[model samples]
Target chain A: MRLIAIFFGLIFLLVGFRNNQSIELIFPSSWPEPIYNDDNYPLNEQKVELGRALFFDPQLSSDNTISCASCHSPYNAFTHVDHQLSHGINDRIGTRNSPAIFNLAWQKDLMWDGAIHHVDAQALAPINHPDEMGSSINEIVQKLNKDVRYKKAFKSIYSDDLITGERVLKLLGQFMISLVSCDSKYDRVMSGKDKFDEQEKRGYELFCKNCSECHKEPLFSDYSFRNNGLEPDPQLKDIGRMKITQNRMDSLKFKVPSLRNIEFTFPYMHDGRYKKLTEVIDHYDRKIHFSNTLDPILEKGIHFTTNEKVDLVAFLLTLTDKNFMFAPEHGYPKDFFDQK
Target chain B: MIRSIQILILFFSLGVRAQDSIPVKVMYDRFEIQPGKTILFQDDSIRIDVVKFYLTNVVVGGSELSSGLLFDLEKDQNYLLIPISQIDEIQFTLGVDSLTNSNGISGGILDPIHGMYWSWQSGYINFKLEGIHFENGIAEEFNFHIGGFLNGYNCERRIQLQGSSNVSRLELDLYQMLQTLSTDQLKKIMSPGKRAMDLADILADSFFLR
Candidate 1:
């Protein structure tokens, strides 16, 4: 226990002090280095705290009703589990499933379509989205600037009282990048701390055989757009990535989702078409769509036995991290609202 | 895959950037706009209207091109003010800058505004046009919302300015755009199909420098 304490202390010292700011950057050694540079966007404790406060604060929305925590609940891997499709201010339902937002430091693009290139600019989407928060960054900052608590918080970290849109964006990025999920059973197994059960191990082996090509390990996503063999929803008519490229060849291809916490984040796909993991697996096993733009990988569905499917479900369950899900530190900082 | 990919993309986000030290201010439009007064133009005035088309891209007549941050003169505010210039000659696209279009954006550019978004069916409104024209002695309001972000009609228009840079104030002569199209051509465009494509092509060709 003493040895463990000292080891943790050493890690805190090394990673906790980046860019002269005290941000806790203690992901496991086995994980790859983060994509976001601390030098450009410093990760201070004050900034992280501010970002956390902002995440829970509804002032970022047009009305004081919606916040980041609304769609992305902390308990459910920072993504709402109750709703298949996410809801925002005035009960507006967004089409896409709210993705599990962990290990973002390794992510290059955001959203199901990978539309947002930077995490800094990512919040601006939900904030000003008419069907979402529907609040402008300018408007949100103006609200924060007027509030004495936020003004003090801003002054403590950024040194000035001005709450510009860029600062809001950068701070939100800091908080989001900090949401690293390196405590899954897969991570523990790789770290040599925990062992996978026989069923889970077999499921993982099957996963490696069939899913690992696109849903790559470590991060569990190759992050490329692929036509995952699902037929397009007739009502939505979303053309996936072809909207960005204007190329017919790229039609029906959406961003390959990260299957890290697939056990929790359900109502899957861009349109929230599949409600169950078994259904999703069955679709992959049988409903391989034959089209001009279907992913070659999914041209032929993988055949899985009934028992193997149960084993797969067992492996998927190992991804849930109770420590992370119930970390008291990430819960609503009651102290934040006290001053406001 | 994510690590190496992130490195490549990080290089781009960092590399494709202006000097970071100077948080400069760009006065988008200053002299062209006067508060408390709405500017008026003739139906026959030579006008060029530019929109920072969101969902779609900007291409010239045949090729995709860069969209510069040319300021709007009639109204001067520090926002992403759309530019309106005289019809001496013009060149411009209705989409984003090259680096931005390549890397992509989340909210500001792609944020849903007006009635341009196609619900959740598609993503963004790549182009928008609002024009008032004389049709059969009736002044009809014509609105062209062209965008789909993905697939065909990804109209990231490229434009070339033909006129010399003059004073601070620039004018939008609607008449110039009107001169290019007769009442018959103007009356036909509704969506980005064949006829709408022809009007878009005319609008693309109408861009010149003054």
Candidate 2:
């Protein structure tokens, strides 16, 4: 109870800074510090509102077909829950899954391959991918320049100016990084306010022994590249990190993902192959695919009984953060664009 | 004394070791641009601005060049730096460092109308030249976007002077380049592969920091 009060008190301090556009969440006291230093791009509600509008707006696309929300739906933890692969404009299918986007401020790299080196530049991949938004920054800028509201948004933060690509990318990155989801049920247990049940306790112990090295504690990812024994797809054939550097040794290696709220962000992996966590564990136990670049953690798969799988699933379920998922402040900013 | 060696040498190796903060300024020497060619102005075609270059470790020769560049502290300023005794004083290529193209966007430097950006692609334009060309008495307009970020053909480079002086600028005579490279070669280079290499090599050979 004291921990929860302290958490809310810190949240209040952040909110006191909110009117100045600085309401960053204080992750549980135990979690490691975030990689995102908000000092460079301080939180501004006006910019975030503008960024959210741009995020949900189709005007960013070349042909008015898809926004970022097209593939990564907010209701599904910002991931496309049904489709195995991401679909973009013209209903064109992409090669990989639209990974859930939150807790990004802690991420050192982005994209399945870490191809887009900078967070500011990540939007360009989806915006310009032929199968995705299919838009050019020049063409997009010309459109935004004409919109009266966008011009107003641009003027409010930046001085009298034309809407440039840089402003759009930077503002959008600010909003994305602000989507931190650190207050889950698992977080409460870790803070010691509440204890896990017997099943959850057993599962937590098993997970610590089996998965904590790669999917480490607190943030649940080591942020290093590893190959988890999945074979390359014949068609998609994504080289993961290797594609970015063109290094043969990095073949099949991928960034280990955070397990925070993993229950909601399903059909997992770089390709969205397993629709359920059971299949993922099953692959680990019996269906371990062979590859030279496989992560040593899965070299000899761990066999779990059905009860163990159930317990593991129970442990993963504790990661859901209803506070972050439905926070009113993060919802669509009705004040800014509520149609006066 | 041991700690002092670590601190002084650490800061000193960058040639920019804070020698009372030398102030350098770039001004257009003015050259006419013509057909059949392009000029590089930034590190990538995606985020274009020749004025804002990141000065990383600065060193002038052989082993010094490698160690210096590999360890630059990265100063955020505009304009390229050419070491003295590296090249002829009359030429320069107009774009970003080769490694910068592949490094992709990391900072707050991607403004579009500055005319040197391609946010969708992972690189910046090394050179951007657009004008009409004339080939075999035929008039033709040309646009060249020469930049290779992922591929080894990356073309952003800085030239050093033949004498002892630290300076680099391309006072473009766009007219001279048009007159030099026939308009036919101008229209051929577009999406930053081999053709970009040839044109960028030409611009690199031409530049010297005077």
Candidate 3:
């Protein structure tokens, strides 16, 4: 009987150690459960730390100059703000603006064109894009395997030093899924921790009347592809979602971006056409180009007074989570690099 | 203690016998109509630089052999191991199924890192056959990437080889597939669409049991 007790105690300790390795995702009660299934890629501290290192490492690129953080910088809410279109290796400019990365746990599809369906598969696009990172996952894996720092990190975390492309992508996914931005003033108000100001309150009401149908609440996005009536750029001639579905109706349609961090994540739209929120409001109010594929809600076009526009912009500001934008954990893993 | 030792010996003997019965090899042959170093297609000398594809759901004797296997002409994994038993017929898919393509990230042959998947699209390129054809002493490149899983665009082909042999050889005749297309029409096809589906059908018909 005593022997059995000792054996059971050892088993319990082993289980406890394994459990402690994994971390749980936390969010407000009002928010829906994340779309990314944690069972497929469980959240563990070691994996997340490794992912953060890879995220900021320029070695993932062919020239070893561009990193995931180059376009998706955390300071700018994980988006490049200096330019309209994203710049890649050899100063090659990509066709579309780099979309902000946040609240990705709820995103079913990624990219402006909704080309990638899964977040786990998303990093491969930029990595292999000739105009982007200009590197292959195979090449990245070979490089990672040679590094003494990575070998030690892999062994300590995965208990094996074998570095494969799948492990690299999955670890990156773990870090990306950990980027949950739900601590905004809007989230605070929803949780009964704070109240919206008068200007912000009016803007919220106006937003519900005009934009909430597509850019929904709490998460600020329904994660659907829609044609927002932007005229096609003659040079790019990008067909947006139609390139994926091959349907004429999906032409000019793009994924609805979250209004969270709208103040910082600009210039706006897939092409970064509008430089200011006022310009976006003006486009929606009167500059909307009529098209067959345009979203029915924006068919008549929104009518916003100058004063109303200010209020709406004020409300959009409340969605910015300062805590998330400056979180130390999401920044560059300085200690990991210093140790290396 | 005596009984347990006897049982262990019995298990060890059974394992050795199982290993001894397992077949050593299953060969795959890549041919171009005629057996030679250079393949003549439509009077043009063609050299196949690469031929990569996936074989999934290999069923033998009503049991699954393995989930999938990637066959690359450049690699040395052309042969496979089969259990030494009656294999009534070998059934396998020429491409990955729709379920596997939609199941997010996968490992091994199904991993996106293999470059089999389209970076912009969500589906894998089921078959990739690249070669250079010398037309008037100038080398012309031809690439055919066949893959599609969506409705009305599914390019997966199911093949059944009917025979029982210690070494089964599957032949991929590139010349036969090229006969379906005119030389002028043969260019590049890297994305999945109508042309990819059409070529996928032609490629599927090019396979035969030898």
Query: How much of the real interface does each model capture, measured as fnat?
Result: 0.05, 0.36, 0.55
* For model 1 chain A, the run of ten residues with the poorest summed lDDT: A14-23
After superposition, which runs of candidate 2 have C-alpha atoms over 4 Å from their true positions?
Answer: A1-20, A23-25, B1-94, B97-123, B127-156, B162-203, B208-210
Candidate 1, which segments miss by more than 4 Å at Cα? A1-19, A22-24, A37-39, B1-134, B137-210
Note the B-chain TM-score for every model: 0.45, 0.48, 0.79
Better of 1 and 2 by lDDT: 2
For each candidate, what's the DockQ? 0.07, 0.19, 0.47
2 versus 3: better DockQ goes to: 3
What lDDT is reached at residue B188 by model 3?
85
Tens-digit lDDT track of model 3 for A32-100: 888887776689998999999999999989999999999999998899996889989889999989999
For candidate 3, the TM-score is 0.91
* Residues A1-340 of candidate 1: C-alpha lDDT, one tens digit per residue: 4555687798676554433666667787766777766665557777887888898899888989998988887787888776767888999987767888887778766677766656776787788678789887667877988999988888766546877666776778778877777688888888888999999999999988988999887778888888888887787787877655546877888888778777777778777778888998999999888889888887778889999999988888887776676676666768989974
Candidate 2 local Cα displacement, residue A170, angstroms: 0.7
Question: What would the TM-score be for candidate 1 when compared with the true structure?
Answer: 0.70
lDDT for position A100 in model 2: 84
